[model samples]
Target: MALNARLEIRQGQGLVVTPQLQQAIKLLQLSNVELEAFVEAELERNPLLQRDDPEPAETAEAPEAPAASSDELEFSDTSTAKADEAMDAEGDDRFADDPCAGGPPLTDWSRAGSGKATDLDDDAYDRALRRELTLSEHLTLQASQAGFTAAEAGIAQVLIDGLDEGGYLRLDFDETAERLGCSPELIETVLLKCQGFEPCGVFARSVGECLAIQLKDRNRLDPAMQALIDNLELLARRDLSALKRVCGVDDEDLRDMIAELKALTPRPGAAFGGEPAQTVIPDVHVRADPLGGWRVELNSDTLPRLLVDRRYHAQVQAGSRSDADKVFVADCLSQAAWLVKSLDQRAKTILKVASEIVRQQDAFLAFGVEFLRPLNLKTVADAIGMHESTVSRVTSNKYISTPRGVFELKFFFTAAIASADGGAAHSAEAVRHRIKQMVEGEGRDGDVLSDDRIVELLKEAGIDIARRTVAKYREALRIPSSVERKRMLKAG
Candidate 1:
């Protein structure tokens, strides 16, 4: 009884994330580009998979006849213009059929996974149109026509290469000199030469220098402006009266000068750089139907259609006599099939979820930001008869293009706060947005919108928030206190 072990059978429920489930989760989180790449890889690997309605193959014609003359080549009667005109006509038809001609289109995710026929205005249209000019391209253009000598131009190229994204020359004179194997004085000269290039404010050593350089180029570098830039710390510290007195400028003139100074970019390098915008390929499209409800559809352009090659897989299976080979082939086939299934499920689930969101948030679209009700994963999950976790998974990294704008599925879910009048739950994000608007519209000379005053205003607007809550929200929004806000107003 003490040593012998008893064998017993028991049943218990356990959740297992099969390969299919894992693939669905993974597909949910991938950005549009990554998803496209994944689909392409599947297409290459899967023999049964083919692009739906592949474009007709273009045939290259053999030379119709040998050249008639040594100096002249005979032109075909079918000219490039005719071909271009035909292409243009086809393009016109394509555009005529485009559903998203007027505004950003809302697309469905069905096209993303099913590899089925989809509307032309699919996910590919959401990409940003602007292409950033790289530093090399920027510098090369300027350097080529900079009017500098060969040696000077070379030095300028070196300096241009050393510039950071903000277009600022980040290296010290001596360090740059050492790298160039030249004296510090020579480095300084090259810097001067480089500064004369296009983008007037570039090659500046500091914020003050950058602004000063720009002002000089504009021929607006007066003594007062010069002094202010030289002593930016003093300007930031509300020493404007001192600045006015020292610069011998009156209040209005000083104000005008300060405004002008503010217009100049402190970080000139920023002119040539920006944080790349997060590109979205919407998983679903929701549009206002003529029948007076939202029409939900999928963005098909971004999706890669795929299917397993039954023949190749069968051949491998047929030839493989060994257990190891059979096991490998079987595993691969199972994985491929699972991947396709997961992708289809992912698209369908996304479409289902997005349709629900549009239904719930339709009021938000009809009105504006003010009508946006507080929504959460639990609410959506309950409505759709799914677990909160499933809703969360569906929303993760998924974007929905709506009439309001493109928003992540998760963006609809925000913590709610009670409205002052005990009406409906207000979104915290909306409250913050309201608070920002109030602060922005506050008068400079009159009563400053204090946290208490903001609370009172919000109450009148049916947002019934407390003074402490207002203060908390204000602080969270990085807004200064009543006293600080008053002082800033006075200074302004």
Candidate 2:
């Protein structure tokens, strides 16, 4: 081996994912809500970036640049303009006039009282002023109402704090009493007092105790009812005969008792507290065109419009003297430009992928699930001249609203199932739907369709699938075996 180092010039081409490219890829995968959050963060960090406000056509004007000296650099707004023009050329008018064109109409309650204030308006105003009371607040108010000595009130508060969301006390009475330097009898007494609060079952230790409290309040806590409450597992299994024997009641009386039990709230505290429900916002909208084709558009309401302020950037850069300040301004300008370009590219890519999906699955939209052809990411990616991974990322967490309903972009891509007659393959989703329909249409008195029988039926319909595959698809659809189905039917 030679000791001296030798220099050689090697020239080749390779793909490199720069920081901006990485950001574009990330933005492509994020849902609309997540992209809004990311853009808001960028707007805060980059001084040259600002949100593009919705302006009327008459009020819109071109942004002007500040006057600069001959020595100062003048930045042009051509890049931003070109990006906007590209987006407009792609499909700006796709959702211009109608915000809710493809989807259902949304009610604007803010403008509901513009005409006149009626009784419903007063009720709405009152509801807007009211706040939902949490479980802890309700319990604290009840504890305050129940008169107790200072020490007893402290113990009662501790017991209330120990209750779980289901209104069951999760703490051991003896351990709590030991920690508080009090006797277990005192703890038990405080617990009993707290159990007398509203909602009927505030401080019970078990499900049986919870039901017992409600039953006692209703004046129905007989020995038979108590026994029935104690054996909840038997009730869940629908073991009617065992419940009847345990409760020592005839069929008619047992039915009445079971109905009463069913009417009682099992989770008494659930109504008071939980996380609020979140609404799903679709990312794309698909509608029928006048020429009998499909029209696809991005949900612009969910997408944030952003622009780079080149005038402000030029002003800042011209005044900076230090190298560090100049570098910071340059970095901000670069980031803002990249972000705007990335957003435009992301929107175009999503629209392209969604349009192709509508084209390929038009049969499904016009007909039904049975006509959904076999599809994959590769097919869509090839049609759109992109990589399969890119298509996958674009489909992740993205939804499209159609005449059929709102569905995820990935919902149309299913594995292929071979056809019995060596024709075109069938979609796995279609096969699963067929299996589900067959199971649902079975009569209670008729013999349940076993996995083998399902395979036979599918083969007769020109679908070549194995018995195990049929069983797998059935299980995925949450359909039980023939024996379990029969047992459930007999029990019913």
Report the Cα lDDT for residue 474, model 1.
Answer: 77
Provide the TM-score for each candidate, comma-separated: 0.50, 0.51
Tell me the lDDT of model 2 at 248: 97
Q: For residues 235-270, what per-residue lDDT tens digits would candidate 2 score against the true structure? A: 999998999999999999889998999888877887
lDDT values, one for every candidate: 0.61, 0.68
Give the lDDT of residue 307 in candidate 1. Answer: 53
lDDT of 1 by residue, 1-492 (tens): 589889999997442223233344456556566677667766665443544345321221111222212113322211123322443555531111111012221222332333222112224323322545655457667665543333344456557756777778877776655444456776687688667666777888888888888898899998878887877887899798888877788989989988998888776666664343345577666677787877777676655555555667778789989786665566555545555554554555566667777777777667643355678877886676544555666687677777745666765554667877888877766677688778877774477787878888888888877889877777765688879978987897
List candidate 2 stretches off by more than 4 Å.
Answer: 1-14, 54-276, 368-371, 432-461, 466-492
Q: Candidate 1's error at 199, in angstroms?
A: 19
